[model samples]
Target: MRPRLLFASAAAVVAALTAATAPSATGAPRAAAAAWDSDLAAAALSANPAAATASGSQSPELGPGAAFDGNGATRWSSNAADNAWLRVDLGETLRIDRVTLDWEAAYGKKYVLEVSGDGTNWRPFYTEDAGTGGTVTAHTYPQEVRGRYVRLRGIERGTPYGYSLFSFKIYGGTPAPASTTRANLALHHP
Candidate 1:
């Protein structure tokens, strides 16, 4: 019985992976989902491979990707007008407690971090009208949240200019990273 159960589980995993990886009706949507799922699945694999193998929702890659590098907030473009925002759909639920914004280019320095249970509605984790250093310092907003959608609203650019990006990451887990910070309070870029 035990052997049969293992065999069944293995088979199911293989089937699921195949199905999830399969191409959908349209190329773009399917590709996006596959890409997002792949990233989440990849992250989970390192944390827990077996759990990664078992979980679904490895579809929908509606998120941003980094191109070049920035020494300090120098990569974000200032072209985003009002309501013209970029967002990240992590593609799965994560127990996120903190979000760190590291801008290498130093242009899109000051930012606001918002988290949502559903992508449609978001609450602030950190907000800044004016930001601080354009260098390599981590601006952290600490909160206990389980969300699939995380968004960064670029309030103001570092050095009063907006550029592009190199990489944007969402760091999370149980109990959260060991740190001290206030809840939902506005902070300046230092």
Candidate 2:
């Protein structure tokens, strides 16, 4: 049974890889090749509700949820402090491939992206020592990371104000189908 489960997992991974690399009938790669190219982060996941929070909000309208609300006009602004941070809970563990920070005029000059399973202990996977203030900035890791909580900690501010973000997005985790997880569980428990 254990061997069968292992084989099933391996087969699924191989199938996904094959599908990602297979060419079209015209003998040309698919236009969305980046979707399957693990080297590039090509997909974006919707921000989970009630999963965002900040260390300190500058105003009620500029709360943490505003950044995840899909509106560029709304933003989350923290108090004027270098230790400001914002976090998002993904609800469950996911294979995070990339993170995008849509910044306003205020941004973090130095920040670290940390991930954790229980939200208590975090592991910093990516760090921007010199972040440039811009409308949009993206970071892709060399390999995917599994975590339920993602946090951005500001070490330095680009402006006199605290960190401000119009939106924070995470990409690249495809959850297994319900049937698949059930089958895998049966195989291991039977």
Candidate 3:
């Protein structure tokens, strides 16, 4: 009876350790799920032209606008380079929650999602080193991240072609007006 009790205790300890170190369904560390919030970023504006700049576009029609046009059939393709990237401006500082990327056949296998208040400074929000191609990927933040700009920096392309996106969606947070006028305040208050 004493030996049985000791064996049971050891078994429980091994189980606990295995569970603690297990990988999640997404093939990411269990801790990665804790860093993500399930909320979507639909309220965001594309803000690509005024707030965004890219490494390069394949053509005018296939430029950044194609990715934000809300049509899944059209896409934006970049020049065949590992360093190509696309950015979107939220116009004002917002609590960013999620980002969805609809990839074309030409996708990014290694990339980083970053945020910035000023276009020049950037901080990584998420990273995917073994990304699968031709899929819609959504990344959510566990906590609110305040920023004006979001960028997808491609480090490795999945195909001989450059990185291509069918649609890029940013969601979450309220859009802050640059300045509020007295009339606007009165209208809401009244």
Q: Could you arrange the candidates by lDDT from highest to lowest?
A: 2, 3, 1
Model 3: residue 99 alpha-carbon error in angstroms: 0.5
Among all windows of 10 consecutive residues in model 3, the one with the lowest summed lDDT is 32-41
* lDDT tens digits, residue span 100-137, model 2: 78899899999998989999999888888888877544
Among all candidates shown, the one with the greatest TM-score: 2
In candidate 2, how many Å is residue 120 off? 0.6
Deviating ranges (above 4 Å) for candidate 2:
1-48, 135-137, 175-190
Error of 1 at 19 (Å): 22
My TM-score estimates for the predictions, one after another, are 0.46, 0.67, 0.65
- Candidate 3 per-residue C-alpha lDDT over 1-190 given as tens digits, one digit per residue, 9 for 90 to 100: 2322112344664575477568878878653111123322222333234444578998877887667667788888999999999987766666666778989889999999898999889988888999987665554646567787888999999888999998887766644343333333332211
Weakest 10 consecutive residues of candidate 2 by summed lDDT = 36-45
Separate clash counts for every candidate: 26, 0, 4
Question: Residue 115 in model 3: shift from native, Å?
Answer: 0.3
Model 2: clashing residue pairs?
Answer: none
Better of 1 and 3 by TM-score: 3
**For every candidate structure, what is the RMSD over all alpha carbons to the true structure, in angstroms?**
16.1, 10.8, 18.2
For candidate 2, the TM-score is: 0.67
Higher-lDDT candidate of 2 and 3: 2
List pairs with backbone clashes in candidate 3.
41-170, 41-171, 41-172, 42-171
